[model samples]
Target: MNASSDGSTTLFVLLGRIADRTLDDATRREAVLVEATLRDSIRAKALDVPDIAQAARAARERGVTVHLLDDGGLGPYETAVADEIRGAIVGHLRCATSGSITVRILPAGRPTLAAVVVQSGDHTERYEFPAPTGEQAHTLFHGLRRGVGRSHS
Candidate 1:
């Protein structure tokens, strides 16, 4: 992370929650509350990581460009937001799985703030898909599709 002459800290949190899966509900709710507190703390400067997805959305709405980094799958937490954030303030959204560890690099900006929302419940689990074989229906689709196939017993 790099600091500017101005007094603003670059904050980045790694969010790793998989899509369409239930996470620690308690933790998620706590995140909302923590996010509010964080906003208050960083009112004088820059802060990051109060709520995972919501914080980014808020930042974007406030003319702060939001850059999201996700593989669309579960992955490890790595500090990569520094390259994208150029504004006076920087923030991050990070999530972790059972065996993964999150890491962040502290830059020269003073009063760097970070908050974590941890829930006590079942973590997200990965799913697998079976490859299609033989002749299957083929068509040109222009929109989203949701399909659930049943397995033979």
Candidate 2:
């Protein structure tokens, strides 16, 4: 999507306009998708996406957040982890119930897909990684599961 230093600022501006008191619900959804695409581009870095586990650790101290645009492109492992992530942030935000959690699947030259869930307010909390196999993947899954979770044990 980075064809020219990348992404149109207009899309970002439109996200702000989602609050226009006159816009119908349908229009607002479109505006959010546009906004998410650009916001993901800006946040993903495209070249060097951060490791999701480490980022999740940091996010655990803050909060987890995403609006899923997965579209079934993510592999099984990513899909499972993404499911966990989707579960983690449910009902956690007061932003628009629909577009509050913005998850952008970014393609990097790395081995695994990156999923960054963002809820922009006073700050943005996001994390993603190329989910590898074995113990590492298990750890990644757990981190995402707990990114916004409070353990009862």
Candidate 3:
């Protein structure tokens, strides 16, 4: 992101450095918040300004979603926590033939988020959970497969 560009399609690299005056602390990391600005409009990027008040005002005016997750800065957390998430999913995937699984970190929080899309022939099942460590994934995939453990007389 160029720090000196004002043209269209210019990228802006901003830090979450809006200070907290109420706490009266002068720490750098503590002052930063877990937030980012999304500029859908041409003039929606005033958060990069030198003044904190103006930056906050622009954020308040332009912000629509309750949660804004920019997890680019969370690489360490993602790497360290992905294996546990994988462990939670491996057992349930025994029956899945064609499917897709997505594992994601919670960004500024603990407990990873995972979504799995299982395909058993034409039927598909999708689920979102905090890294399923149980039969949740198994049930979704197993049920989609017909006549698995049936008693035939």
TM-score for each model: 0.19, 0.36, 0.26
Clashes of 2: 7
Pairs of residues clashing in candidate 1: 13-92, 13-93, 14-93, 14-94, 14-95, 15-93, 15-94, 15-95, 16-95
Quote the positional error of residue 133 for candidate 2 in Å.
2.9
lDDT of 1 by residue, 1-153 (tens): 111221132221213332334447754653454344345344312223333334443543343332322212111111222222211122222222223211122233222211122222443222112222223112111110221112121
Lowest summed lDDT over 10 consecutive residues: which window, candidate 2? 45-54
Tell me the spans in candidate 3 whose CA falls farther than 4 Å from its real position: 1-82, 98-112, 131-153
The deviation in Å at residue 102 for candidate 1 is 5.0
lDDT for 28 (candidate 2): 67
lDDT of 2 by residue, 33-140 (tens): 455444444554321122332232233324333333443334455456656644443323222233234544444344545444554555545555554567765566
User: After TM-score superposition, what is the CA distance of residue 117 in candidate 3 from its true location, in Å?
Assistant: 0.9
Output candidate 3 Cα RMSD.
17.6
Worst ten in a row by lDDT for model 3: 40-49
Q: Using alpha carbons, what is the TM-score of model 2?
A: 0.36
| RMSD value for candidate 1 | 18.0
Report the lDDT of model 2 for residue 25: 78
Which parts of model 2 have CA positions greater than 4 angstroms off? 1-67, 71-73, 78-82, 89-100, 107-112, 117-119, 146-153
How well does candidate 3 score on lDDT at residue 28?
A: 31
Predicted structure with the largest TM-score when compared to the true one: 2
Q: Name the weakest run of 10 consecutive residues (lDDT summed) in model 1.
A: 136-145
